[model samples]
Target: MENRRFDIRKSLLRALFASLCGVSANAMATEQYPCKPAPDEGRFAWGRIQSIDPNYLVKRILGPYTFKIPYGYMIGRPTPERLNCYPKQNRLEFAFWMPDFRAPKKDMWSEPNYRVHEPGRDAPGPQEYVVDVVGLEFIETKAGKSGSPGRRFVNGLALLRKDFRIEETYGLIHVVPGQNTPLSDDYVSLSNEGYEILLECSRPESRDSNPSCKAYLYFTDLQLEAVMQFPADALPEWQKIKDGVRILVERWIVKEKPT
Candidate 1:
């Protein structure tokens, strides 16, 4: 009986040790990602409207899309035209489509014969609009791999993990308007000049291999959340203050020192 009891105790201790080790592994994986200031020299154009003609605000967000980069994660951005199809290669696209809220101009997608333009120019379909993304924050959620074809939610990033290995990252992005451009699409005539933009990033559903996915994507994070900041004031004339606030945003990237 004593020997049996000793064997049981040993098994229990072994289980406890195994559990502790699993927990430690998860913690270390989380710690691998760190946040730092983004490079301030990247360029961004608003809806592709002739590059903002050298406005102060346009100059600021043009900087690199630097918010935070996890050690093993990838990243990408969307062009003005690709915003419609939600480009699969370069950027993850999320849409915060509010039913009651109206767009500044017509929906280019709704247009009978829409034509997308190249980068460095706005879509010829609607009035020009600028979005001032003051700050960006990312949140990661671990979704176990069960081949369940999990349900996706807007404004959330998905971290695909199996046996603690982060296999995939999906992100949702949100963008708020900062300036207005001339009307080219009908959706632009809505009540306001601004709208919230949400973008989702993940593996292309049609891709066949990991290399194919990487060729088209910026990076991979099991899940990522982009927290875009706007100004406290809701002034109708966001464009007027865009230059000033944009410059301020450049200084607001995340910075955390490794311990």
Candidate 2:
């Protein structure tokens, strides 16, 4: 009888431990996105932005989907004063910042003499790139019969071509300016990577614009789209940037186990 009573107690203890663990996990999950939703304002309902640690895991939920972003990334509005928030017109927008693999240097000499004297020291070091990711819950009205994410991507490309008069010839994409296109004469040239490319600079006529490229990509896996702005000079490294962005999105999505 004593042995049987001890076994029962052990089983109870195991159940109690499991329950505690489950509660702890749930608490952590709730803490991921600590913003509180406010009443509807205009078209969007603002969420109170909190002073969160940069290393904190951020979470975003849309309909039946949920995304959990790991540490070393940042997400927020364009400006703190901006009242725009999610669930606006069935779309969500946010800025994401991640480390650039090409720019691994975090520290550098600040002395002007050192910079001037050292060869290749005056050259600028790569900095973290910010990408705007927009989540669309509904299919675009113009993207007719975009049954799959891939079709949606094609539709996006078509729209860009129609609006900007982009021409792809001999393995190169030439951005030909249209009547309303805010592009200079061949200001943006890109090799097609299956993503929409645009000018990243504010002034397309300036010399700085030549080296920058703004790319829009549709993520089929996540059923979302992202706009990445990076130096066009690093066109050769487009594959790395694309892969990194994919990994970032993949990390955010929560995978469900088969029942």
What is the Cα-based TM-score of model 2?
0.48
Model 1, 1-259: lDDT tens digits are: 9999999999999999999997786455334322233342335432342221111111111112333221111112222233223111222221111111112222222222212242564564332232222123322223342111112311112232212211211221222212331111000111222212222222223332211100011011212222221211222322332333233333333432222
Residue 196 Cα positional deviation in candidate 2, in Å, after optimal superposition: 7.8
Compute each candidate's TM-score over C-alphas: 0.19, 0.48
lDDT of 2 by residue, 1-259 (tens): 9999999999999999999997787577555543354553443422222233334444455534555553324323321233222322344444343344221121111211111222454443344443434333422324552224344334445545345565653233555544445433232333334433333333445565224555555543344555555554444455566667677655566743222
Error of 1 at 94 (Å): 16
Which pairs clash in the backbone of model 2? 211-232
Distance from true position, residue 211, model 1, in Å?
19
